[model samples]
Target: MPPLSTAATPPPALRQIGAWIAGLRRADIPEPVATVVSGCIADTLGVALAGARASAGRLVAADARDTYADGPATLLAGGRLCPEGAAFANVAAAHALDFDDNCYAGFVHGSAVVVPAALAAVEAAGGSGSDLLTAVTAGTEAQYVLADAVGNGVYHAGWWTTALFGAVGAAAAAAKAGGLTEAATADALAFALCGTGGLRACFGTDAKPLLAAQAAAGGVRATRLAARGLEVPHGVIEDPRGFARLMAAGAFDGQVPATLGRYWRLLDPGIDTKAYPVCLSAHAALDAVRDLMAEERLSEADIATVRCRVPPVVAANLTYDRPVTPAEARFSLPFAVACAMRYGTLGLEHLDEAVLADPSLGAAMGRVAMAADPGWNDDPERARRAPEGAEVTVVTLRGDSFTRFCAMPRGSAARPLAAAEHAAKFRACAVLAADRVPGPAEADRLYGRLRSLDRLPTLDGLLTP
Candidate 1:
């Protein structure tokens, strides 16, 4: 294999991936695939609907109105906007709570990146429900493949893989829904590469949601530009100074198919739904805290100190172990662990300003410490591999110590949530949006429609204002 920095000509495989995404739109997606896609769609909407009333979501909505476009697509908060604006706003809303599903391949939030683009594109084209589902599957698969190709090496080089490759996945999804030709899809992909960039330093800021929104908007723009016969470099992905070369330390060595219809990666690996609102990497620590709480019957008053050992990757991304704000706490391993240990559950309420202002939570957060354990680096095969989980050791004032190791979080693929659990989560998140829609009956009706999304003739039915 050539060095990643080599200015190699565009490889045929790169174009083939783009062609493959184009082909997925025309291919027959199985019922199982459709069901999963529907689930993801419903899950994303529930998150968005809840987030629409959040501070960030409100700001995005206000901005969308200012940058007005004459289009039929509905921004999550209220009025209609152009497809790109809608995609941007919806993506921001979906991720405002950080509750969307994740793809471990590159640690990208699958639904956050793909769903908004799909919804906006499909709505703009007046596409059928089936068309929207197919495009989502294709876009999600493309994201996984690309993230797998570049995520690990890029993260190792201090890049956020989701914001980087998410543009390509979002573009691919939009292209498929917009019915772009293979060449157009390829060009759209290249356009996506030109617009791709995001930093981990912006993790705690509004920039995190903006990163998702930009990818969503940019992807739609790229596809629309491609559909208009715009030209872009064919070898943009593999060329020197291209995405893989500039953003990642490693080259793309994986065997991506030469044609678009080889295998559906969505069915192979599937998506991982999140049970918590915080970063997925912090999930293990939360689990460990939960376990210690249950086994040792530990209480805040009895606990003197909490120590967590996690993989280096998790430690690297969770730079703020003791954060001052809710957003900062979301990315803080120690803060999440401390909250889990103190409150016995980490939820939206826990992330509230009032909860964050709790003197007890702050003191507990201060007592928590995290260490990187080499033994936890168990995901050697994953693109962005990390330690398997966290080991929490809580020492009590009475000199009693309790220890628990979490290998996987509850909602992870290894321990998938049951349908009832998913429904419960949906209801819980929906409650947060009670003021927006203002009735249990309305929420139930929307939830019922989403649960049966595939049967609907059009997705527009689900977006009732």
Candidate 2:
């Protein structure tokens, strides 16, 4: 193995990566990339609007008021906050329900991190809509690169890669939008490293949203600090005591920078949009459960036991081995699979406390079991098959059994939700917000405006009370 010191040298490719992102003019960005960025933006906005009423979102919004800035930026919720605060609040809201787009390369929520940072930067800098889209694309691409470099090392080490690597990507995006030089962008990234942290243990709690929020704020702070001439180690990312080495517990791979733009991580691997709001790892099991339910036409009462075979990686993150609360159920693979089997679908309504507390659902959830498939984890080829796929088996009281396997969860990049389904999801999320905000007509209009965010001249006009 190479010495850790060997990793400290800044690869020549780093400068080239920085330059490529900085050099992208609005018109220079590909139209497909721009359109995808728009879709991500719209999806994020819908999540934010829905999350604004969530408990975590409200708390984050309140804390953000302390950092208030009288700017053109629109906070996802009703109030106005500073650029950093707005980014934090919006990102938190966007990720509150865990319904944002995920990048396969890094397994991070790309839109939640990039969209918040770009929107804040554009609003604060008085930038154009095209600038916002370009910055978002660049930021998302940067995140995927960093995530791919780390591989699954961070996850194996129990770090939430999204919050860890997301700070760097968010900082890069903000720095680009802020017109920072290559040196400045590197410095901003260094500053961001100081704020990086998140654990999978915090998944079911309000801390889940806080993870993304802190990353968003840290990104903005990094750029602002760099703009003021703050100094940071140029080789922070590659340094032994720095991000990659400290977080991944290994020497930096020389191949990371070489792959930066040679392959567009965003377009190549692309984004995975969640059909169900539960953990992405649980999606496959959910799909399998739903399949068995349909194939056997079994009612919840007829089932004796439900078992799911899943990858060890999924098993590791299913913190709620047996969940008692609605929040806990969201992270429990067993509970999610059971809910899918009994209810036939896992919708937002199913996550409600009342639904979780239902005796019938509780009984069904208790009957579900999850076991790790050593084959799935041991075989490198099979492990790469699908991050969220699983095999489900159901045993009935009549001594009959039903089984189903899912290679990819619904709404994944491989099996995307159609336009109508995406619209329905947005409408459902909008309804979550409409319940709190007055005037149903105004709320519907706001939803329409959010769907057309790319055309909006100013985000300020969208936040009317």
Best by TM-score: 1
| TM of each candidate vs. truth | 0.92, 0.91
lDDT agreement of model 2 with the native: 0.76
Off by over 4 Å in 1: 1-11, 25-27, 257-264, 374-388
What would you estimate as the lDDT of candidate 1?
0.77
Which parts of model 2 are misplaced by more than 4 Å?
1-14, 67-70, 435-465
**Model 1 C-alpha lDDT per residue in residues 90-202, reported as the tens digit of each score:** 88889888888876667678788888888888888888777778788878877777776654667657677677777888898899888887888989988987888887788
Write the residue-wise lDDT of candidate 2 on 283-354 in tens digits: 988887777777778777778988888877788878797676666777888778777767778887777777
Q: Each candidate: what lDDT?
A: 0.77, 0.76
Which stretch of 10 consecutive residues in model 1 shows the poorest summed lDDT?
1-10
